[model samples]
Target: MLMEKVAEILREASAEAVEPRFRALASGEVMEKAPGEVVTVADREAEAIISRRLRELLPVPVVGEEAVSADPALARALLSEPAAWLVDPVDGTSNFVAGHPDFAVMASLVRAGRTVAAWIWQPTTGTAYAAELGAGAWRNDSPLSRAGAGGDPEKWRGVLKTRFLDPATQHRLQTGARVFGEVTPGRSAAGMEYPMITDDELDFILYWRTLPWDHSPGGLLVTEAGGVCARLDGTPYQPEPPGGPDGLLVAADPATWERVRGALA
Candidate 1:
């Protein structure tokens, strides 16, 4: 399966890329990208290595964060391609540049607009999560099952989703349920942990932005892990839809999904 090989490559590349960069930053290197965004040399180097490795393995096209423009037309065309890899070589680049250990390498194989395989590697923690269509999800070598056994939010330990809530939204959630909100160390790791925490007995997770490379792989992991992922509006996730918005909402159990959806509403 694509996930296994991809995971192997990711683990290797992430270690090779992040270790040195982390060291450089420790030695005094300012990291900055856009005016407000931050990036380190590690981001560019990691993307190069990941891009090379992916090209060698599959020889298919890739749309990566550092290289891709925000052109909707190009994104749509790439997603519609029969075979393409969406790569986020260093998700949470801001965190990595800032010496935070919450960044990750993320990739997804999209076919006909649907993610068929996915991989996410947390470089600092040496954790790799992957999944293939119908094959199930795995963290390292261990398999991941759904949270709560049968969509029971109460039985779950934690849940993850979006965090774009306003003050009113937060207040509503507090009034209805006792759910706790946790911000993961990095976006990529947080994305992977969305499904993983459920496997760990967590109740739910919420996220706001859904970058192609970030959520595609993470969403597949949850689905394979026996969980459900969707948009905030309860719509199924479609990476390569002919025309649609770019965002994601996820939950370990259906009950939690509905519960969180209501709070957002």
Candidate 2:
């Protein structure tokens, strides 16, 4: 029931605060929150709606991306609180601002430093992706699982997102990634990438940064779908206990994860 409720909240937030502003963002609606990190009016508005609804639904700390940007300390709640909600109102703010269909609204329920449930709502496709820790993953009402056979690392297709890494690390990753048969700097959207992984559109994705809101929901979704979402060192990815190694690798399955990690990490 909670999964269904959160799914509804995600849809509501997207409908009420995201879809209408898809490409209609005004001059002041978009702004750079950090040097290259962008946020939009839709992000703030949708976050507010999602956070409020989340609090009412579970009364936990709602640590949203926008809220954390406003007050970084709010992020600590993910470590200290017994349970909390992680929200990324616009997972692809840049895409949304560019009128691209790759953006999504995402949220995850974290308890004792672990993600237990998650939801991703893509307004453009009118699709809701969800997962409960042990209940498995879904696309709308249908179950979702990794759909392809794993192959040699050299024949794998995936993306390498190294923007957040240091120059040296980036170069190393870029060099190491040559082993893959097909690699591209992916669309900077975890919400979209995770779904693609589950659907077998890609074999793996290597991320240099693992912001909780950005990765938690999709991490759980991928894992629940019989894929693997973990830190580069093979540690389980958790929302709490913030600040760890910089790499995250999500793949179609365990073997794919190991192969990718061997090549990149």
Candidate 3:
């Protein structure tokens, strides 16, 4: 119930939100948060739209990256509420500020410390990915179906994985039989390094990160897509962690997940 309704709201808001900012990026005002962190008027405006819409759709309290206390302790305390919403109005702010389309508007519903549902919308691309606790994941209007095993690795495509790796790790990946592409920084790029496979091309995607807003929606998307999601360390992701760190690893298919995990390990 919450998942379907929330997904619908996100898709509707995304349609209204994506274009204005997509066009404004070049002329958009920019600001700095830290050495590698940046924000823009577009980010703030988008957050406002998402927050307002979410508030209207669900009465629960929301904790967003830009609107909440930055301290991990404070964030943990605030998110520890029995039922709450986690939002990343723009999950890839750096990409957005740089005029890239890889950014996303993400949201998740957390109940009793567990994420029950999630939504990730790529505004620029007009793609919506969503999922719920027991319901399967979906993209646009289609339910995600599982891919059967095949002899050719080229034929073995399914839900993809995305990760942020340093140059060394990138090199390791190149030595393997896996096929991948470097995600271009700007433009509404979904599926980046790991993409959801449908019709022989990457489409739907769920990015994993420690940011509750980012991963919560993505996790739900994977689960609803009939896939599994977890941290690289294979731990259940919690929006409110005892300590704060944002690293995550996710796979769309269970078999693919096992192979990727084994390779990484």
Candidate 4:
């Protein structure tokens, strides 16, 4: 119920700040956050709106991707809180800048280092995915479940971001694709992966970074939809900062997780 409310808020904010600018971004509307990272006016405006609304609804600290980027201390402040909100106003900023359709607005409620609720909204199609830990995941109010077992490693399909790894690690994984089945590079769209996993279009997703605003919400959505979510070290997942010791690896089920981990090992 709380997540649904959050989703509604995101939907409204996204419609206002995100949708209208989809393919209409002006020359100066886009700015560089980093060499490869980008930010658009839409991202900033939507995040500001969501941050204010979320704070009003819960009166808790809010950590948004754009807000934290502007003020690093805000990130630490939110993480130190017993309960706080994590918002990725526009998860796939790159795609959004490129006018791609694979983008989402996501938020998660992290209580004492654990995600208790998650909501993700796909603005283009208006599809929403929501979950409360232990209550199960849902797609637009319908109960959701992941696909059945993948047949073989050689045939398994998943999203893999080897580019995020060190060069040696990337080369090793690339040359040893036999053990990995099929690993496609994703669009870096945070919440988009879980929908693919839930629909059986993807078997797993391995990301080399674990930003809470990017992965936490989707991680719980996968776990509640009958998937296995953990770090590469096999610990239960929590929202990790910009650089953590391990990355996020999620599979459609426990068995698939072990299979993929064993392959990596």
Give all TM-scores, in the order shown: 0.81, 0.95, 0.74, 0.95
State the C-alpha lDDT per candidate: 0.67, 0.88, 0.58, 0.85
Write model 2 residue lDDT over 80-125, tens digit each, in one string.
Answer: 8999999999998888888889999999999999999999998888
For candidate 3, the TM-score is 0.74
lDDT (tens digit, per residue) of candidate 3 on 1-265: 6666766666665556545666465543777866767766655666677777777877777777666634445356335577777777667776766667777777777888787777777776777766667766677767766453333345443332335556776555444425423222212323322224422243223233355655566566655555556666667666654246544545546665555555444
Model with the higher lDDT, candidate 2 or 4: 2
Worst 10 residues of 1 by lDDT: 179-188
Q: Candidate 4 — which pairs collide?
A: none
Candidate 3: where are CA atoms >4 Å away?
1-5, 8-18, 26-28, 69-74, 77-79, 148-209, 241-247
Cα misplacement distance, residue 50 of candidate 2 (Å): 0.7
Better of 1 and 3 by lDDT: 1
| Poorest 10 consecutive residues by lDDT, candidate 2 | 239-248
Model 3 Cα shift for residue 28 (angstroms):
6.8
The order by descending lDDT is 2, 4, 1, 3
lDDT of 2 at 225: 91
For the record, the alpha-carbon RMSD of candidate 4 to the native fold, in angstroms, is: 1.4
lDDT by residue for model 1 (1-265), tens: 4566788888787778777776467543554545766666666677778878888888877777766633445465455568877887777776676667777888888888788888888767777788888988888879888754344334434433325457775566445444334423224455446545445545455555566776788788887886778887778776752234644556666766676566545
Winner of 1 and 4 under TM-score:
4
